[model samples]
Target chain A: MGVRGIEIKKKTTMENQLHIPTVAELMAKGESPEILFWVGCAGSFDERAQRITRDICKILAHVGLRYAILGTEENCTGDPAKRAGNEFLFQMQAMMNIEILNGYEIKKIVTACPHCFNTLKNEYPSLGGNYEVIHHTQLIQSLIDEGKLRPDDGHIFKGKKITYHDPCYLGRANDVYDAPREILESLDVQLTELKRCRSNGLCCGAGGAQMFKEPEKGNKDVNIERIEDVIESNAEIVAAACPFCMTMLRDGVKVKEKEQEIQVLDIAEITARANGL
Target chain B: MVSQFIFLGILTIALVLFGRNAKKIYNNIKLGKPTNRTDRKSERLKQMLLVAFGQKKMFKRPFPAILHALVYVGFCIINIEMLEIVIDGLFGTHRAFAFLGSFYSFLIYSFEWLALGVLLSCAVFLIRRNLGHIYRFQGRELTKWPKTDANLILIAEILLMSAFLTMNAADYKLQQIGAEHYIQAGAFPVSQYLTALLTDTQASLIFVERFCWWFHIIGVLAFLNYLPLSKHLHIMLAFPNTYFSNLEPKGKFKNIDSVTAEVKAMLDPSLPPPSGEVARFGVKDVQDLTWKNLLDAYTCTECGRCTAACPANITGKLLSPRKIMMDTRDRLEEVGNNRDKAGNIQDDGKSLIDNYITREEIWACTSCNACVEQCPVNIDPLQIIMGLRQYAVMEESQAPASINAMFSNMENNGAPWKYAQADRANWANPE
Candidate 1:
């Protein structure tokens, strides 16, 4: 169980528990999935982020969407390398990934991480890797819009005050502001906005390779400042879309000693919980 | 005849000096590496029109936007009156464009209104900068010269607008008295209030009118010459800056073609080795930056909007995007001066990185694009920061140990962690 007492449902108990297929498995079956679910490095490894990954999988299963994961073949999108100024390593990684993606004939991708989403959608095109890429929030919003998924009216999150933190790569970097909020609205939660939301949204201090190391000297940590906004919004729950933001904000809530009061959950997690998946 | 000669001489000298300064700036920008911003011609023009001509981005901060728009529009429209001033100065003609009759009156009437707008707007700006305690105006980068430069331009605008109105008032009095060569061809709506300040006598009125005319013309010329020296260069540079804006998703940093070729050769053994003098990986100095980056440096308004919005600066980090642009421009100016003195760029032992901008500032950026988003002229400071980082990592291999650790992790394990690639799918059926 996570800090918020949101039980991490085991694989055996998940409803309609269809086995997720990797791209290689689908390819071996002489078929192609409709979209590729790019579970980024954090989603695969980070404890907190892995829970969101499971919820996303549950949503895809509930909706019966034909999605395939890159699995062992997926590489880091080299976002941190490119941003940290290691263009050589970034290009090398980009070339290898582009080769594999092209080989797989992948058309569209949905990622839970904005860093991977941003790189694959925006930066990869110039490196001979182009595909229709979308964040998981966009995919979730569309699923709700298409009437394929619905939040249970009497779900636990009903009327709960939740604020969405805009991931820099998702919001300002790509301008996908409304999709997450629209998803929240459908979940029947009170969507309170931070003072700095949308294009003016503050970073969770985990961007631009900053997550890999200690931040440069400053008066206070950037995440602490962002947590102040979350506190100021007075929302009981903070909804985030990016794995990096999840880690940073979760750490911030603990630092502020508000873990007992405020629960930091990804939009995917909230949606999954609201739908009783 | 003597006054006409003197006027021509002053105009010639001012134009010549301004021309030289413009050439120097052009050459300094030319020193930068070139990137293609010329592809999207129509889109560029449209952007220039909307962002620069239309003042669209300025309106993001409504209060200052309204005030800035007043000064901008007022000053621009008033410059139309400069045609008459220039013609009047040349060939020693009085009211040279006065032959248009009532239309001239309408033009003068509108100019008077705009002049008054400019005068008041500049006064308000001065107070806001000095007394309003606006956070955007105060920063470590704004100490001394930048501060004085801003106040000087505001004060100059106020003086120029006052001179314009005073000149009009004295001219109106001359017209009322029906003095020689005073044709009474223009309207005196706003300046009509100032007419009482001048004596009714023709001798005194003529002296006052002539004094103001000379002051207005001389002041305009001096200001023109001063544009190259102050942050006021944005008044002219913003147009081109907005035009050459990166017209792509803000997150899409340009891929280094040199690195691409090297990577291609490495991946494909069949390909021949890349043959060329290796270029520097990223921007270490002004010359290593793209010409568009250099132009962005020149186009900075020093408004501090970028810094005000920066997450790093907000968190009290050393990074300030405005300071990055300012430092770039300052180093460029130093380089330009060196080239002028030596007839070529002499090694100054100082570079943009580690000298003007420190590693602390560069490392503090999260590349959030808040700075880039807040820039009214579409200046991209994050590009320069990345460029500096590129130099540090590729050309110098000086990236922080943690970043290097992440890099090696990605290189070996295919992720930025120590976990094995074979275990990547373990999340699917976690224990």
Candidate 2:
């Protein structure tokens, strides 16, 4: 029985059994988490953003903080609709999700996509559903600052040259530049800067709902412009906080056929790895 | 007395042509849908002053900006000379503002310098368009009518400025000779050199001066009428267009009012559900766009700055923001022409989409806002692209397969993925 128990313990992978508790499950048990993890459309589905979402979850769990995801209850924040000019469709989606959140009495919301973050933090108030919205990078920065989440020896990213690519919505629209930079600094990696960083950051050709369709005809690709900026920075890893920027920059890397040399990782993914998650 | 009548005759014809063309443009702009740009009054005024008057956005590309400012400021201030021209044309007076004395001399000197500036700038622009063959001006869109329109305007300005200078030069010689009816009025420092060329007899010199004077004044009148048909319409429309520019945050797309109302009612819980079906989804014709959008079409300088900045255009995509604006103006002009002939626009069996602007062009747009940012006149090409895209996706269900997949995913899974809602949390629990 002792040998069997040892084998069972070894098979219990933390990655497979993240031990995620749904908001409903917690509520049924008469316990409420402090913050609701609004895993956005990309974070919930896209393979790349999903990794970032998991890293966020791992960090939250490791910090021993009480947090819960909406599970099946969360919906897309209707960013693409508003951008694609489908205001009707956007409202329909926003209303359904807002109704669910208001019903749950959820207040503080944290999301990974700037698209979702912008819509929730800036757009949701006008629709009469208000919540204290925080981006994942902002949350990560605060956790690091408060000594709640400490970085390890930075085995993977230590001394690695990393540069950040700002998402148009986040950097230009919301002005949340420092939080991502601060979060990246925690990994003890050498941080590089793109010439057109911060307010002047180029779009990854993914904002304004462009991610759903192919890029328009033009002399140069916008993602190529952004990736060129990253390449010029001479950073080994491209640090992206927004999933849309990750998608665009990753595609741009493949276009340049430099995927073997340069890696694109989200801030959360790098931070989570550095913390030995 | 007969000379005054001739001047009045030319003025009457010019003003009539100008008035008729202006009325037609006003009516065509009225054909577009209404949009409220009345908010933020102070900001609107500031935009006008900075963008239209200050030429703030033009300086992004310094060389062209300086040349453009020269021609622009020259054209405007030189028109002050027109006040004198009008008084002279009416009352048979020479240098009517000559009573202002040194100020008049100062003004004419300034006018002569500006004429030289306008002359030099127009020549360079013409060479750039024709011989130098600038890349932005060499696209397929500039092959015929647009190319000619650009060249014609430049050439016209060159001729007009030349006529003004020749007339001033001849008058200067006539003044030096003290010829009959040749008063010692207005200064002409630059044209003074040309007085040396006037070695012909005083009678012939007077005839040369009179001929140039007729050509210059008549040419100005013709240019006024020509403006309604040319991209030069921007001279008049840029001010109003910039004044009513969209003042919202650049990234924010306006919400559809009907949808907003419906959503508001749904969220209220106490309100009843919507009664009627949505009338339409998005723009399908020129009439659907705001009057400001139509105004934008009329005001486009055809400079291709937006297309040059467009990523889609850079990557060899069919989406050109300049082309979009041109197509809008072309279609608007077509409608206006039809109305002028038939008293109302008939169903012409054509629409802005597919006929003029293609689905490929509209769909190709990345919505990057680069085009909007680059427009010197504050024309938002992205708005038209989005409006057409809205029609494609919502009304016609003709979006690309990738986009259709996304729409379906959003409809069914509440996300832009094919995964079921129950499995949305699987990313966290990776098993």
Candidate 3:
């Protein structure tokens, strides 16, 4: 049988379907989840990003890992406020979130957004909210390492050309460069790296709360400049880990009229599609 | 005896001037707010050694790194020769360390090679700055004074190295003819070749030898005093700046403690009220910054690597990280000078934010940490930009319209968008 057929046969043996449970719903049943999924504001509200969010949920369910989303209870992590220099607003949001997280006695958290991941992991501690935080890509890499999720079983992306755009917050800010690349590497795709990758990765122009505002007067939008790197990579599929990058890259591709030629997919979505979930 | 007195007098004047400049810089840095960079003793030391001493980060650009390493090593090794010159100048002796015999000769031989390296590297640097089309050196902020300042330092180094080599060559010629007090003490490798350029006559060689010797020493002293006023201060500040660099993750900006305290009080009414006088929200002037930020300004060599890597600046935005550091240093110097002249800091109807760094430049930053990552000495120009932004947002409430809308949405809707909190999890079951 083909790899896809074999994967389907193996999947049929497992009875658990893709069901996303809220932290509140799980708590009502007196059942605590193994992990709390922090769907950031972008992943929660952004249309393109919500697909990636659902894919992440699908992956968690496929792996049979008990993970619950904060759902309506989760608030913005105040990354934009902090970056925009609204320290008062940032601290207020941080205190509220810290209270909620500590009240739940939460120990582990995972998020798909680099901004949220960076803030929760790095900025939350000083405000008395400390959790064992991991990015969704990091979680995926670990799942692959544990042999729970097998990318080799899915041959959909066996030889497709893909490029991974390292989000500034994930790569340079937190030094989490390897996990996403490793997950991509496992997919058997022709991974082309941009000239600026890893610590030298260029920004998509949506960081520092710039996503919420129009860019200052410049010759070209920062996303368009970043798109030049994507075009130079000559990859058909551009893999992104951050929702902010997904939006910016999507816009850039559309502006360049290459949306028909290039596809911007988050790493979670790619992994879930590869698994035929 | 007359020459010795002149030498002593010049040395005393240079030392006194340099000491005063150092004190002024110290007090200016002290004008900044206090910060705790003293933690992580061993890590800081290691960082200083790796970055400043080893020039580790400079290797990111290999060609410039090589040239800079030559100049850096030459600058440091040549300073050892300065010790011998200082002793000879003070004691009216020739090659005072010549007592070490062959070891002194070995040191002089090494210094000659380094001097040659420095001379050539500086010449290349001058060409690269003025002639070569290096984008980093051609920023809008580098016009006029900044440009002249860089070229001037390079020319000075070239002149200083030439004077050193010519002194060695003339001394070699003097020793060959057995001129008085021109005792044969050290070996000359690079300078020995230059002996052909000197006149063979004894009196002329002596004149050339003495003239070059005096010029080299005076030039060295002048360079020492010039450091405080020039970007060359990086030579000294890079060490301490790297030592006191932010050790946390680049994404982890410092939380405003005053804001944190106020927020904590608001969240819990049972908690005691926040004490002390009301503090300003963000940096409006030099004094609002941390001592480390001030040190970063002084430590900046204006290489523009930060600007070159900046996505905003790369895409033609006004936000150049190098300019931020330059403006900070410039504004700090203005404040320091004002205090020096007026007996205390008198407001000159100017602040660092509006007077120097523009709101346009501050808002253009993407906060990507590329500048922070690209900085060789770990200067966090982003911190300064963020501080200025804080002042604009909280103190003045003059954020751009779009950003103001974002703030209101974040405050009211619990998100940057206008979506309701109730629908936040709608993505979980998105069709």
Candidate 4:
């Protein structure tokens, strides 16, 4: 394994003691975790996706579920490459990550980004990598259903005008529509619905590797159109499941000068806050 | 006999012209890179039947859908009559199918009704395009040649159908007067009504019938060849284009082969280091695209439904899915012309990116698949946009600054940020 060799170079920098253990660290102690938290590129680095990663981690921790992160060994699942039409770069990224993943004998994976969730669950199987991949919302929803975690009534989110924006990958691409909505329902918020929600949900303009590029010159920005749908719903808080949607919708809110009026938050962030984390 | 010989001469010229144009189009489409769309034969057949033959997607909008279906069915059924005219023109037989008697009358009656339907449908379509002020038609894409092309086809159809009715009406009048050589054959239920307006000179009626007959036939031949240049090519190519459409889950993207090989090598230490210069990823030029993409370009009806459905377009982004397909077709045509003259594609010092479709238009695509979903003929403009963006980012390194930051972050930190890999666990620890 390239683990020990690569670990030595960055080992000294791990001075801050975090509760999360790397997969290599766990396996070194001969412990096999039940699930691997596949914190995607966005979750690992993006400030917003990081918040989602932490909230999801808190939810798992609150339920006392066994999970570990790959840390240095993990890499992007190449969802961007496939979307950008650079299959070569995507394959290079996917094959290396798949090798590392399969080496650890990983079985179940949970991710925050719908892009990663889509790629890891659907696209990776054909390349000889397979795992039971679940989005964080689905995992958390199931946990709540199993009575592993409970939401208290009269919480901060109770009776709030919250509308959920479905991420394209999670909704249209994978048909995981109900899980996020079900999770939001637990918070006691008036679950308002956008006219274009669920299967007809409009994209937040971050899909198809569009997050990485300036939107093509067009009559209007897609995020603005998506945000307009949210505005029409007249919900005070715009709830989202995917980190990319969070970024795009947040930007759209700012563009419409509604950042103060409408709050953009991920399901995990809102859930973690609701649970008094 | 002399007239029959003259008809044969004219027919031969028309066939040669049509054949030459068809061959050029076939060659142009062949210039694209090959893709294997033959994997799912049954699915492709099913798709062709539903989308192309059944017009299932078109029915989403009731009014235009019905009119389009009428014109489509009329175009197909009217061609059956064209076959008869060809046989009669060749053998100099008057009403060559008259031998079928009542069955022939039924066919003629149906053709008359269809002819009327076709005429009315074409007129309505023309009105919708030129007068309706529909947003899809207002875009820059509909200007000049595209606009003229659509109107010209409708006008041509209207003229052709009118001539068919006039020829039949005059022939019916001539037959009623018991004129020389006016065969007492064929039903004229629709055109018989027109005979009420005819002047009683038998010679003038013969001239009108002959002129209308010649005009309709010549017009049909001219329209046949014009299809390769016009968006009306959808009339013929829709079947094969729909048949070859990508049947995979709409969001799935194909893995690049060389990238796969290189990655496989990286994973297996026993495999020797990969050799040979790697090919550029994604599409930048006409030849880089799959042939099915070229077929899509040629098959586009420019109906602009895709543009109308596009979120980016609706929000006032420069991206129009219809424009993407049109630009691809236009660039393909330019490439075809270049290839024809140069014997092979050489750098014309231009490509689809800057020379035809702009980088702004390519980048504007949100990849929402709304355009793909809205396409009546199953043309996936998002695929072309993705291909171009791939070329822009990987090959040219022309990705916007923000994307560059994301890419760099991923390359250095195993994620799309400047944070160190070890700090990833810090999200768990919090501040």
Candidate maximizing DockQ:
1
- Leading candidate by lDDT: 1
DockQ for every model comes to 0.83, 0.40, 0.80, 0.37
lDDT of 2 by residue, B56-110 (tens): 9899879999999999999999899887888898999887888888898899899
Q: After superposition, how far is residue A115 of candidate 3 from its true place, in Å?
A: 0.6
Model 1: CAPRI class: high
lDDT, candidate 4, B1-431, per-residue tens = 98789889988987898788778878878877778999989999999999999998898678999999889899999898899888988898777888888888888888888999999999988888889988888887887899899899999999999999999999889988898877777788799888878778998999999898889988998888788778999998999999999887666666666666777777688998779987767788988888888889999999998998777777787778999999999988888888889998778888888888887787677677778877889998988888888888778888777777767666676665577877765565544
Clash number for every model?
0, 15, 0, 12
Can you tell me which runs of candidate 4 are displaced by over 4 Å?
A1-35, A45-73, A81-89, A132-166, A171-201, A213-220, A233-239, A257-277, B99-102, B174-193, B263-270
Question: For candidate 2, what is the recovered fraction of reference interface contacts?
Answer: 0.54
Task: Please give the interface root mean square deviation for model 2, in Å.
Answer: 2.7
Q: What is the per-residue lDDT of model 4 for residues A1-277, given as tens digits with 9 covering 90 to 100?
A: 2322432333233323336777898899999779999988778777777757766776777788889999867888878756765565677677778889999999999988888988888888878789999999999899878987777565577888999998878876777889989988877889999987775578888887787767665567778888999999999899998888988899999999996679887888777666655
DockQ of 1: 0.83
lDDT rank order: 1, 3, 2, 4
Candidate 3: which pairs clash?
Answer: none
Model 3, A2-36: lDDT tens digits are 43364455444432455689878888999988999
lDDT of each: 0.91, 0.84, 0.90, 0.82
Assess the local accuracy of residue B238 in candidate 2 as a C-alpha lDDT between 0 and 100: 97
* TM-score of the first chain of model 3: 0.93
